[model samples]
Target: MSAWLFDLGNTRLKCAPLREDGAPGEAVALPHRREDAAAALAQVLPARFEVAYLASVADPALRLAVLEALGARCRRIAIARTQARFGALRVAYAQPRRLGVDRFLALLAAHARGGAALVCGVGTALTVDLLDGDGLHRGGRIAPSPATMREALHARAPQLPDTGGAYREFAADTDDALASGCEGAALALIERSRAAATELLGRAPPLLLHGGGAAALAAHLPDAIEIPGLVLDGLARWAAVERAAGG
Candidate 1:
């Protein structure tokens, strides 16, 4: 019986099978543009899976498309959702559904590692969530990601091309300036959040980074742990709980 997990983000789709050890196998990522993401999914997925689990943070259209595709190819499919509490992680949101499942899942995965953690996700939006050692979510913030910042700049100014940019400390050119400005903004936000989290928690939490743009920010975040497929890892944890509860 084959089980598969899909993590559909705003710009990319990631999928992999659950290994016997309950870990996701070598995952494959597909960009939403410059490629037919659905076709890639079809090509990569097995002919039929016994069960399929999905976590989506994209638009309704993207979610619908993925559901339609997976419905036909799997014996059963379950979509992960934002919850008030799961495992050791508890949502800070009074209205739990208002929180993004991706964020919740990231928090779950971070807490499972056994300590307070500051989880940062750099995807369509730069999201940071702080989870204490007791699994209490300390809320989080969301801001436009570097790519979004570039796109927004181009959309507003047009003269400043959004593409082709390099990050530099003191940028000498427009490209470098754009690159550095956006990335520096994100780095600054994370650093500030880490400091504030330390004060609130009475101890500094380990910074955990994930998502597509994580690598770009990793160098600047000296001690941040790069956890691959965090959302998927979280999904695996959720699935186990579901299976145990007789879902």
Candidate 2:
């Protein structure tokens, strides 16, 4: 039976074929805006799928619209949710539901690699999560991502451009300064989180970066591992575990 994975975020929706080996195939992304979603998905989805596994952090209306579209082409749909525990991985959130499933799934993917890690998601928002070698969640932080920062600044000041320019310690122009300030703020938080995680774990954990805007920061963090399909990867793991247990 053929299956697929769908990761729906605030800005876009990413879908991929689920291979027999239980990994996501080549991914295709589409903006989740109400007007564009249906047409975009239609162009990418296969004629039919035996199953569809989804993890969504988009608003209810958007999710429902996507679900409606998927239901027409998929035999069964499995939604990914944040849980207190998934095998050995324990969630740090007092209320698991409150933790975005994307972040939780990212932790699951990191834990499955069998090591301590500082997982960072750079998308609509910058999210940092810490996981120990033993698969224990160590909490995390969230802040407006550099892109969001730029957009917000531009919204308030019409003269400020929302995009472009380069990052520098001290920029000579407004565009460069805006870029440096926003990107630098995000980089600073990641560095701080990494330092704290190191102190708490007594060893520096490897950094894992994912999401749409990760490239912006990845250039600066030489050691950071980039996993473009992180959320889908985690969803794949969840799907495998569930299937094995006959869920």
> What are the lDDT scores of the predictions, listed in order?
0.89, 0.93
lDDT of 2 by residue, 43-111 (tens): 999878788899999999999888888898889999999999999999998999999999999998999
The digit string of per-residue lDDT tens for model 1 on 89-179 reads 7999999999999998888888889999999999989999999999999899999988899999999999998877788999999999999
User: Which residue pairs does candidate 2 place in steric collision?
Assistant: none
Candidate with maximal lDDT: 2
* Over 4 Å off, model 2: none
